[model samples]
Target: MLYREAGQFKTSYAKDQAVFPIIQDRWFIALVLVVAYGVVPLVANEYWLQAVLIPFLIFALAAIGLNLLTGYAGQLSLGTGAFMAVGAYATYKITTVFPEINILVVFVMSGFVAAGVGIVFGLPSLRIKGFYLAVATLAAQFFILWLFNKVGWFYNDNPSGTITAPPRTVFGIMVAGPRATAEVRYFISLTFLVIFALLAKNLVRGRIGRSWMAIRDMDVAAEIIGIRPLQTKLLAFAISSFYCGVAGALYVFAYLGSAETEAFDLLQVSFPVLFMIIIGGLGSILGSILGAAFIILMPIFLTNAPALFNLPMPTDLSKHIEEIILGGLIVFLLIVEPKGFARLWQIAKEKLRRWPFPY
Candidate 1:
């Protein structure tokens, strides 16, 4: 009964095409935002902010970027970490060279740098696709990391080979570096995620997004219908990389504060993000958030569950168990609901709309 929209009527095309056409969805989103910006900050402890909320927001952004390419554009990439690395290093370079510029501007510039790199790598997609395209991006994953690892200039010649986010402020409040508080960092990450997610939502609903979908469904048909494959595919790569880049900047500045190339390795960055899109739902923005949250929180739960239950499982055994469980769950979920958590959520909503008369 509560989920019914019987009285709501769309009188115009604009109303019909609204992002949240359902009043309940808009209200729910508003409530979520209010809690995230208002209540969470006031109540959350340091650990929750630093370890949970901040990482969830950052990873969700990255997952959304991947979803756009893999899910919407039908491009398979394994170089997510590489693109993120580009962003992190670019941000470090820009901030160091032009200290006068705002950090937020640096983030956007870093995204552009990653986009350029993405386009270069994406060029191979013109003639190759599917497994070949994935292999090409995998090559980028290794090559970019090697370049960053060997290049002393990229790290500003730091002997430790680590790039650190130097203290920066937004309107006189510290948001990065060692002195920055968790609340400030969380807020900054949340702000960025919210802004970019909105932009992504709109972008995916526009003309270019339609072109991407056309390409994804069938490139040959898309080309026959006047969609330029080269432009469509490359634009997907560029925008997707741009999102990953900004997420990388946030990962360093808002979360990690300092990181090495190893931090963005396949296991640490790429595969997990791919898993997020798979487990979250390939073509869904909300799925990215849900997948990220599940991936981030599940591990924490696994690690702490033994202690919480007063079980004396060994640390190494517990880790292996966690891996086994995660692997099993992924297989099980794939078999049961291949479209993922987002689809499950949609199904539940549909059922709710039917209520007691669900057929």
Candidate 2:
């Protein structure tokens, strides 16, 4: 009853087109923000912060990036891990070379580095698309990883070939490095996610976003209507890679603390993010968050389920079971709701608005 919009009347265009036009939705979002920003930090333990929340936020960002390209722009990319590597290595170099700069600035600059690389790779999108484009991007995945691994300069000629984030402070609060607390790191990642999410939301609602969608629906038709395919497609790639780059920076600095080329390997990084947007819903920001949480938490739940039942399950066996179950769930969701969880949520809301009616 409280969720009804019967009394809500939009008197202006701005109100009608507001992000959350319904009063209940705005309140719900506000409540969620309060809990995430205020309550979670105080109550969450090190295990929750380190093992779950931090990764979820980072992967959510990456998923959103992929969705922008594959979902909204209709440009298939299997090189997400490569772009993330660009960001991670770029951040490491920037912080080491220019120690006086702020860490936040380092992240943004790293994203631009990734954006430049994205534009180079995205040039191919002008000619080919669909499965062929995916193949081209897969090549990028291999090539970028090889470049980073074989190039000693990326790791500063370190024999270990590992890059570790140095301790950094923001407003006198330690947010990264060996001595940083989980709460601080969590807060930093959360802040970045919130800021970028809002930016993404606005971007998708603006003119550029509409151009991407037009190209996505049909390139020939969109071009006939004056939408430049090359410019729109490349813009999607740049923005997507930028988001992934920032995610890579956070994944290493805030979550991993130390990483190598293997940290952003194709299987571990790229495929999972692709799965996130597929299962969560393409072209939907909220779906990215939901998908990340589901992917990150599902394995943990599976590992603990046997323990709860007092069943003796070997680690290897449990892992296999988890993989099977995850695969099955993906198949089920694809078969039943190809648009994914976000679509289901939308349908539920529509039904709620017309409660007690057959329609």
User: Model-by-model lDDT, in order?
Assistant: 0.94, 0.92
Please give the clash total of every predicted structure, in order. 0, 0
Candidate with the greatest TM-score versus the true structure:
1
Candidate 1's TM-score reads: 0.98
Relative to the true structure, candidate 2 has a C-alpha RMSD (angstroms) of 1.2
Off by over 4 Å in 2: 356-359
What is the C-alpha lDDT profile of model 2 across 258-352, one tens digit per residue? 99999999899999999999999998988988888889989889989999999998899999999999999999989999998899889988888
**Residue pair clashes in candidate 1:** none
lDDT of 1 by residue, 34-81 (tens): 999999999999999999999999999999999999989999999999
Candidate that scores best on lDDT:
1
TM-score of each: 0.98, 0.98
- After the best TM-score superposition of candidate 2, give how far the Cα of residue 224 lies from its true spot, in angstroms: 0.6
